[model samples]
Target: MSENRKSKVGSSAAVGNVGKKARNFKPTMKKLISYLSDYKLSLVIVLIFAVVSTIFSIVGPKILGHATTKLFKGVMAKISGTGNIDFNYIGKIILLLVVLYVISALFGYIQGWIMSGISMKVTYKFRKDISEKINRMPLGYFDRTNHGEVLSRVTNDVDTLSQTLNQSLGQIITSVTMVIGVLIMMISISWQMTLVALCVIPVSMGLITVIVKYSQKYFKQQQDYLGHLNGHVEEMYGGHIVMKAFNGEEKSVHKFNKMNGQLFGSAWKSQFLSGIMMPMINFVGNLGYVGICILGGWLAVKRTIEVGDIQAFIQYVRSFTQPISQIANISNILQQTAASAERIFEFLEEEEEIPEVSNPVKLQNVNGSVEFKNVHFGYNTDKIIINDFSASIKPGQRIAIVGPTGAGKTTIIKLLMRFYDINDGSILIDGHDIRDFTRGDLRSIFGMVLQDTWLYNGSIKENIRYGRLDATDEEVVQAAKAAHVDGFVRTLPAGYNMILNEEASNVSQGQKQLLTIARAILANPKILILDEATSSVDTRTELKIQKAMDNLMKDRTSFIIAHRLSTIRDADLILVMDHGDIVEQGNHEELLKKNGIYANLYNSQFEVA
Candidate 1:
């Protein structure tokens, strides 16, 4: 397979396996816990409330058992004609139980409210950090990584952490508290019955362990395939037009069906295992119940334990088993949480771009005198694409770079903008190293119009104003008129106010190019870079764009990367590149007279035209 296809396939495979079991679960959990550190006081309060609520609930059955015992004795006394039943005592116990339950419910509500707030705050912080990290990240990261993969971390992974914190965190505390409280209550009633109940726990745990071990892989697979499926769908939707034009519907459908089938299998298996856990645990609890009942009955016959005690012990057993089951389920959920947290933390911890200097050079005025001295660069350092390239341009010069594909033409523009830094040597603007300025300050001085135009879903005026956010409506309209966009825009129903769709398909290619040109015009930067800016337009549109560009470049240092030699015949200087080196450099007329590399390239284009 071609390297590009291999990379795409590899990326797809990597996306599917991204949610597999975390490599370092303990560390990931630790990192996740650190996010909650800021809310430690609130979490402590929530913990206290959770414990108190559980204690209240746990003590209820035991307290109610006392009433059962009291009523039983009263009935026995009444039947024997010894004494009257204690109605007032029973009434007091019932009222006390009601009060305890109400208090428990209130505490539970408070804790839930606090926990939810903490979870939301943490989620907000997570998303905020991711957004900031995206800005600081290098462009190479995006080039190598899939867009959907990054999006998954922002959306899916963060959501998983959020939901788990909101729901499972409270559940874990409550379940642990319930289990401990219930066990104590059971033992207080009768140790023999408690021992019998405890016997079944090992069996239940053994079954739970086995089920979790087997289901863990399926759960991982399910999550993995879910990401893969989502990424595939997004990719197909984004490129649906091209795919359809190339008649790739069958292939797309086949891939979708294959992935969907794997997802279905994994989902079904994971859910089935998770579902059976409750039933299996419940069955074990029932077996323990039978054993406890027999032991309690024997003890009661010997008057060693009361009937009421037996009733409470059974309730305790039910309570004990329930929390155990909950804890088991929660364990699986925690695994998924760890995986999600790991992905998010991994992204946040990625290497950012080189830090800006503590004290940066502030330019009083940008004269647009750009010089590249002994420049060496490569996307990969070991295989340099630009080998010791050097160039110099005076202020307000229109320098055109003409090169064959892969001759590092676009790389020069990127280096000038500092999208990627040069490996060696200095890129200076007005004799100050570009690295001396902050990335934002350095980038702000340059305006770019590329072959591929980017405009978001917004009105034409809003899109134009994106170049200079503070630009007035009048300024925007002037820019549009300068770029020859006003005439075409006015013919539309909503004119400048017409909202572009998500893909901006409402406008033709030429119109899109025009809008981008207008955006550049509004920026009014010191230096302008045009990469095949008029490539998409027709003869008439190209002429109009050329006129606008000529006016735009009149007082600015401009760099143009063009394939058509005829268009740049009037350039101040043309640097003809072959391979990675600038083989010839001169004005078009001078190079044509030299009959060198530039001459041959110009002659070919002229003949083709």
Candidate 2:
């Protein structure tokens, strides 16, 4: 038990040490306010309701004080034998107080109803905007960012913003109004006592400000650790099977526990510091309450203040501290909201893909011809990958690209598909620059089967139909039969309707590859890109898939990237790539006689087997 306690204490200190001074937040806040500008009218209505409700509520204590004065005077008069009790006046005052309280509650409810809708609508629109922004972002952006970080921004940060708006937006306005109103009422009763009560404001604010100064860093650290923890967990879960197979469970868990501990420490400190605000504010309030009551009693005894006035003054003193405390709490919440808002804005402001042609040209009766004219390109211009690379292919050509790892094998396909634009030079399809076509139109002409198989949680048939949404059942089955996906799919418990599960773990990797092939075959694109498409399957399954691919490649431009030389032996033209440059280009028979890099690569593969 002692060790556990010590560990927790140490964990908190380590996490708390991540504190760094925050930079200027004015620009981020100004931009976020700009997003809220569209809801100006709705906010105006909310403001009106909040002000009216607060005004009505704040006026209540003063009117109730009138009833207290009336009751006190009546009792005193009866005891002094000066006059009779005026119960009628006292009853009227109490009735009006009840009516005022009810109206205040009604308006408060209406304000909350309207504000809830506005807050939710704003968050919904922000979420929608982020979703569209994600699509507009280049693939390179995703490559550089973690999937969980992006997801957390969408779910976590957006939720934090929404929650802050809902809980604190109205509190800020109402608390300010109540504080000003209470001060006025207190002065009207007894300015001397009001002066004493006013002392709580500065004391509470000072104490809270000092605590907040230290707490803000922890809050920011909490958010960062939360994001990192989420990303790490997502990665570990994604590769859980591989981790366990290699006996990496202990390492993964240790890393997770470390991150989780940091998150816990920061989260607790932020909460603990913020939580102290209420109790401390309440303590100072009680001190003021005691001081004011003592001063009011002496003033009443000296006949400088009436019994009713003293009662109203005491009520005013209590009400004053409540709003001050609420405002302090709201200030802390604003800091956290600002942190979440900054993260969200950063994602929304990321650079988008380059604009497409204003007046794009259409490919009419495309002959599947492609050409790379002195294309100079790189993921980053400082480090050029494909330099002065040039290639030309006729329609219906079976071109295989062979290269060692990191030789820009996949970069070539990405460029042709326009997933990433070339930095310099040009790529033309049928003599027309590829840039002259919309990305949607350019990508529409090609079918890609990558090494990774992506199947969402759905029925087997639904996954295939994703290729061509409008494809008929007959067409889906035909494509499946052609790719041999129907063979194993039919053996499942529910056959074509079998659920693939979320990770698509219900089927083997080889089967997943076959399903993707079926999807591509169903789409029947004008060009085909097979990137190690048969790497996951067995020799027998590879033969079946290869036969299907051969039939599908007829009369279509096909680019194959493979390390298996046997698979590409029949390729009409083989381009041997090393360090992003093609060193040799010829058919199997011709390259063999040359005994160049292509021959060496082919021989190495056979030797490995």
Candidate 3:
């Protein structure tokens, strides 16, 4: 028992081992820097400006030292009657410093413009690539992932990395240049003072290394918790009606509070450490400055160095410390930016489910005969949903599939649409395997109406036109009339142009279903699949919908799936499925005569209704 407890504890540590993961995780800085390859000219300009800016900045302090030293010498010369004091050098040095300041400011503006453009361009590229990849992905990929996670990756994560790349990169470059330039200038003035300044580096480095390591872990956790919170909020809001109907608000709030509390703690820790960076580095910088001032003052009093040189060294110490503090402060932003980059790259690294064929087959003008030959499939490998399933339908045959829920009813339609490929066997269209046809050519032949319809935020006309992008207004009207939706649509103030937001939420469920029927009809597909299309509507509406379905299904190969068995009485073939196998199949009267599974389901629904 003791050994088992120790093993369990060890397992727990492995599961929660964030520190080990972080240590092993490598940031994609090299890949990120490759984005700058296209911006070589801009980068060159930035580099030039940074160098000029640092040079000018370094000169300003040295000029002040020279001027102060000259002024003191002039006073001494006058008191001692040393004949003359030269103000010419002082005047030239003052002018040079002023000119340098002007050039530095100009370069600063140029650098800002170029880096901002580069960052925005990189962000645009990242977003565009993600969008394109999403378009090419299989539908099942989205079914398993949260919508909010995708949104956060594109918006929040990309935005965070963009700011870091643009602003932080520039600051790091400028700080390093300024620090180098100041130290070089300091050594030229007096190596003794340069040595004193260098002494602070060890202490500053030790403190920063420790703080950064701790802050990095917290920052990454902060991002992860925030992602969880976003996912929770999106899920809760998306299912609000169901939650409220079941009075699950308290439970939802408790879940949200738990996620929110974790986010709050991680965020506080990350930000608190980042916030302390400037002040802590500033204190260290001040200590170094005091040392420089004290040591330089002593050297000057002993006449080992000119008073002017001491003054210049003091200014150099100030300049050096300022950039060091900035570098230390910017380290936090760098870490955060690196964390965001890792996330964005991670998303980009996900392998797309549907890869384009090296030599794709483009099929044209398909005839509607479909065959499923011993198909086996599953969303995952462990549990096969459709096993050794075989079905064949002739052109324009209307088949109705009635099954218990989770008996691979909807899975059939999904597989037919290539939303997923069969694990074994082949689905054939026009006697040709579906995998032999290009995805576009294969999907173009079928139109599907689902149980839960989706309408985009657009005018009514636009939603119908989505079925056929180039469909005419007259064509749309004809389809709408056939679906029996034209009557309600014409009554709206805007007629066909009436705007619908939140997917026609203001309309009744039956009307929404009708609109979807109109869309499917507009497509004029050779094959149709209705997955419980009329199940949500009232009896009267269902009858009306049945008439529309009759019109739509005419002379087309139609696959209808529904648990409401009464609606499928006129189907050419009725397949009653149980536990992923067809238990009975025949015409409606034949199935009724058989007194089998279909008859039992029919009687059960009739009793319930």
Candidate 4:
């Protein structure tokens, strides 16, 4: 598997899902054509070369027929003792045939080379477009949709598009040209024989039509099942440890087998239906060849056509049906390409995050005195998860949010950072509405260390440098020392230079959090958000990390969300939340005296002990 597929293990990028109901194909196809509008000149050149090449090939049979006729006439004259064999005529015909075939081959080569470049260039553009599109899309889109589905569009669907362009596009041009050019040559030699050869065309069309009608549904289903099966595999692999701990291995295996069976059924059915076309067309072609031979023989006996004309005409008829067969195959390829294309276009057209305001306010000395007034929001409008919430934090205050699992602790941090806009009212930072500032400007004022640690595959030093790109090596070490990450680095073989693997699994989870804390220290933001940042480590490690975070958050406004209530006893203000609303607010001693929800949650941790 590619790195992209590995990264998308739990997302739609491994699976395929087009947002909304599947659109009509014609409109999707029209949109795909619009992308090709940029390569019109290359397409025209490809067309000219294909036509020229086919025309050269089409004329070969007629010229070869002339040689056959000459040899025949000369032989009969020799039998009458009036003429000898004409080696000069035969030599000239052979030379002409060689020249035509060579030119045809050259044109075909140039056409393939040009189309290959065009296909690759178009695919590059599509990939770039998608990369840009995803960044601009709102975070809510990812929240609502499957990440695996998006991954499939980027890798699988785009791959199909590239193949079709490189192969089928050129084939369509050459096949059409060859069919037209061969038709003219056949009619010129003997229209009566041409008619007999053309007799099977309608039957061939009817067969193709019926097979295509039934086969397309299977092709579409095959794509869906492939994505579905991929989703199952991705999920199983991602959470295999959890499945095993719960003794659900048999269930997981059974689920995979079921999906695999569905995928196999759709996959082979589509292939078998499409595969049947080639042999059926070949059978029709053979019948046409037989009709031409029998008819041409009768014509020759009557002296209506020469034996050589019969041979050349037979060649032309054969060439004619070969392209028709190719076109049928290309037709099937085009249908699959169209399906992939529709999924690609659907993603490109998805609703994006509202564009940032032009000439937005830029913060100058952000002290991070944050306030939320009557803020209403939700991941979905039908169900509001944050309702009429309000809060005010003084500069340099540490606010600890304590609640049960679903009590909107992290939602407050997300809203403050403007990851999602409020449905009503405003979140103000430094006395200005957050929306007044650009997202980049707003986010730059704050640093975050979340429950899930994210560390890219890079040297430890480079990962720290991401926080402040121009920070000196000494500065990186200083930040590492402040976060206690320096202690761990000394034991590593490469020290700070040791490389992290793809998942950053080289370091322990507690160590990963320390590195992130070091990065946040390097950033030196005016505000900080720690969402269960120390929850993964042992008690000893948590104490060490908590000390480092305390130093890092000193004199900076910070919001800490921790499930362990004891960790936030020193917070200036403690907010007790239930559902989307805050139920109580005060210092720890004050909230404990109230004996309300906050006191109950705080005492429960000790009750278990």
Candidate 5:
């Protein structure tokens, strides 16, 4: 497999390695907060409302306890027949309790609305920044990285950040507020009871710490194996045809079963461990409750505290424990958020393409003359591929580059397009360094058609018009006819209007090549490049394309990278390359007469045929 494909497979297997802990939690969170700085005012409002809402909720049970005490006293008085029960006083307490809860609900709803908007706005900004960053990133980065890895940052990581912001942010504020407020209420009622409730926390926390520590590794394993399983399945499905041809179904199934069994084992263990936490903590809390109730009854018998105080303390105890659990859960969620935020920040901070010159030269008319003067380059600086290469082509000349595989043929094209910058020397066009002109202007002078044809999901006419967006329907058809695509397109239903599927698999490979050729023809560029462009089509169709290309090459500088020597026999100049240097250069017949590398390469093709 190619290095790029290997990187993709490795990336897929490691994708689920996320959702664990962040390497730099504090720094990641600090940077994430900087993004929210833009919405400081809104966040403040949310904070204030959240605190207010939680306070109201915290006070509700205490107020209701007063009503409970009033009712109890009235029953005692009526049974003793002492002065008649005060029904009106008890009714007033109940009414006050109802109003407090209703207002609490209203504030909670308003805060939730504002929090949701803030999270969505932050999500939009994250996506927009990532989108723009992708454009500015150097092509070298993509050459070494997996496309799926980049996509995961754009989709999965951003989504994780968004959900945490929308849901967990508010929960964090409320949970903390509840814990503090309920603790105060419990203390105010009875310090003794508050102390009893506080005892449950240490035990609960100890068990929780142990559970999380053990289950964390299982959770990570589950996610890791889940990624592996998904990657294996996707690879198998994508290459099912190749697998069947090789009759490797048994191997594929066995691999899948192995991964599936591992995923099941880890998933079950993680879930079971996580599932036991709540009941375990609740059992600990129940023991604390038992002690508090016994102490409360003794205190009431001695008349040291009101019945209402005991009831309110119990409510505060329940409220306190719940938020502690919520806070613990939110802590885990925050860790995941930090991990996601770190990935996004790392992408945004990556080295961008070399900055464009402030005053780049603009060419009004390109003459198509090009020269490579001692150009030195390497995908890696340590490993020079194209070393001190030099070549010159005049205006309107047909130049053919022929070499064995891995002879730096495609690297030459990539250098010309400025997809990568050369480490040494310079490439000149029209007597000016190519870098003097803006990359956009430099690339605009040339039209390229490569072996791997690219077509989007669009009607055939639209695909052709992509070469020249301003071209009218008549121009599109003329270009299509020139490339011999109009005939086959007309035979299909809907003709040029037919919508291509996402993969553009609806058309044959040769037809796809023809459409791309039609696109390049419509560009009407001053310089043209064809890299094994006719390899997909049969000889009969190739002849027609060659004729059309010949007409299009008139008065235009063209470069052809071909393996088949017979195809470029009529070139104005043929350059034979090997190991990143030109071994020979001349017309086809002149190179053949030399009986050197070019002659040997030409003879071998015919021998293979």
Candidate 6:
């Protein structure tokens, strides 16, 4: 039991450290406010109405207290002097209360409408900015980050901020103003009783401070757990097929349960602490109220204070305590909003890839003569995947690159496309360095089909049209036939209009690869790249795909990366690669005679097949 207690204490200390760091870790209020810049008018309107509404709230309670005092005095005088109630005085008090109620309600509506508009405008801009930023980010950024983490930043964090703005801001403002107005009223009624009421202020604040410290830590943990939950679920769902095939269901479930249990505990702790806040404040408030009541009654009965003054003092005490309690509640929300704002701002501040040159040269109708001069490249600064590599291809030549896995075969194509700039060399397209051309110009010159073909959820016609947005229906059909995918499309219920399911899961792997080839064909690029394109298909499908590829390669520069040697047997040039260097180069017969790495690979998989 002692050890358990000590462990709990240590865990609490760690949580305390985290919370303190989060609270003091620079609020992004200024950065978050920038999103509201576009809606300056609405924000100003909200502030104006909130101030007016708060003033009305303070005035209404004072007017009620004043009317109650007047009624009591009038009743006492009438009963003693005339033995009848003063109807005129009664009517006046009723009229005053009604007037105060109407004014308060009117300002309340104005405040609500204005704040609602501000919240909506801010949310809209927040979503739009994040979306645009995601689009502008380099492709490699997404490769390194999880999908669900990014989603949590946009969807969950922004959603939390939206609620804080809509529901909490106006109440906080009004509550604060009411507290100030009530304090002044209390002093006017009876300074002694007012001081008594003030005694609880510091004590209540101290208690609230302790609770807030506890809650802040749990809230931050809660947000992180939610993000983890999102990421875990995404991973489990995306790889369900692999998991089932490996018989890893139990393992996956155990992992999920552990994460889910943490999420549950964190959520409960956060909410439970927040829920206790209101009641705790109320309890302290009741204690202060009782103290004030006893003291004020003693002074009133002794005639040191008026009966009316005691009544007003009690009213003021209630007003002060209520707003302080409300402020405590708002403080909790602000902590959460601050936590979410940190995440959203971090995303906004992420480094984007360098922007395109102001005036880029556009390559028109590229002839597809490619040259790599002493190219050295790496995805990261410290690691070089391709070192001092060089290659040249004349227009319309079919060059095949064969290598063991991780020999930088795919890196060649990436460099040509400028996905990551070369670390130590340059690439030229038709005598102009590729960097001189705009991204669109460089990409428009080549069409690609990878081993894992991905199709969007859309009709076959639409997917093909994505390759060349301006293509006519006839052009799409021609390209499909050229790629030998038209026959399969015609067999579907909707032909070209048939909708592909998610990631083209509804189609066979071979058919999906062919459709992707059709997409590449529709673009009519000057150069073509086939990166293990036929490896995932059946023998018959490979034959048909090879026939289509041969037709597609005609009069175009083609660079083929293949593991199977038979696919590249007839190439004009075959380069055997090892450790990012070209060790040998020749046609199939020549490489076979040399009997190098290429010959061995060919003998193992391709020549024998």
Candidate whose TM-score is highest:
1
Q: Poorest 10 consecutive residues of model 2 by lDDT?
A: 1-10
lDDT of 1 by residue, 1-609 (tens): 111111333235564454355777799889988888999999999999999999999999998889998999999999999987899999999999999999999999999999999999999999999999999998878776766678878888889889998998999999999999999888888988888999998999999899987777776676667767777787888779899999999999998898888889988988899989999999999999899999999999999989889888888888999999999888878877877788799999999999999999899899999998989987778888788888999999999999777787888888889988889999999999999999999999999998888999999999999999999999999999999999999999999999999889999988999999999999998999999888888888888888989999998999998888878988998998876788889998899899997888777876854
**Candidate 1 at residue 83, lDDT?**
88
For all candidates, the clash counts are 0, 0, 0, 12, 0, 0
lDDT of 3 at 604: 86
TM-score per candidate: 0.96, 0.95, 0.93, 0.94, 0.92, 0.92
Q: Tell me the lDDT of model 5 at 399.
A: 97
Off by over 4 Å in 6: 1-20, 81-83, 302-309, 606-609
Q: Candidate 2 at residue 154, lDDT?
A: 91
Candidate 3 vs candidate 4: the TM-score winner is: 4
Pairs of colliding residues, candidate 2: none
Compose the digit string of candidate 4's lDDT tens values, residues 445-494.
Answer: 99898888889999999999888889999999999998888988989999
Better of 3 and 5 by TM-score: 3
Quote the RMSD, in angstroms, for model 3.
5.3
TM-score of 6: 0.92
- Model 5, residue 155: displacement in angstroms? 2.0
lDDT of 3 by residue, 1-609 (tens): 110011111111212423221332444676677756888888888888877877877778877887888888988998899845668878887888888899888888788888899899999999998898788766655665666666777888888888986887788888999899999999988788788889888778777887888898887776666666677787778778899999999988987887788778878988998888777877877887888888888888888887888878877887887888778878877776666677777777776766656676665666679898988887767877677888888888889988777677887888898878889999998898888767787788899889888898899999999999999999999999988899999998998998887647767788888889899999999999998888768898788879988988989999999888888899998777766667788899999899888888888876854
Candidate 5 regions off by >4 Å? 1-21, 83-85, 210-275
Candidate 2 wrongly placed segments (more than 4 Å): 1-18
Best by lDDT: 1
Model 5, 1-609: lDDT tens digits are 111112344433454564454557689889999989999999999889999999999998888888778877888888888856677887887788778888888988999999999999999999999999998998888776656457667876788788999999999999999999999898888899889999999998888788776666565555456556666765676567689999999989988788788878877876777777778878888898899999999999999988988888888888998888777676656655775687789899999988888898888888899999999988889988888899999999999998888788888888898988999999999998888878888888999998888899999999999999999999999999999999999999999999998668899989999999999999999999999889899999999999999999999999998887878999999988887888899998899999999999888877854
Candidate 1 vs 6: which has more lDDT: 1
lDDT of 6 by residue, 1-609 (tens): 110011112111222323232443355767666666877777677667766766766665566665666777778888789555556776786787777677878877887887887887788888898999997786567665666667788888899999988898888877878888788878777788888888888888998899888888778877766766676677768678889999999988887787678778877888898899888888888888898999988887888876767776776787789889989988888878878888788778888866777778776567889999999876667877788898888999999998888788887887788876788888998988888877877888889998768789999999988889999999999989987889989999999999998768888888888888899999988999988888778888788889989988999999999887888999989988887788899888999999888878988873444
Best-first order by TM-score: 1, 2, 4, 3, 5, 6
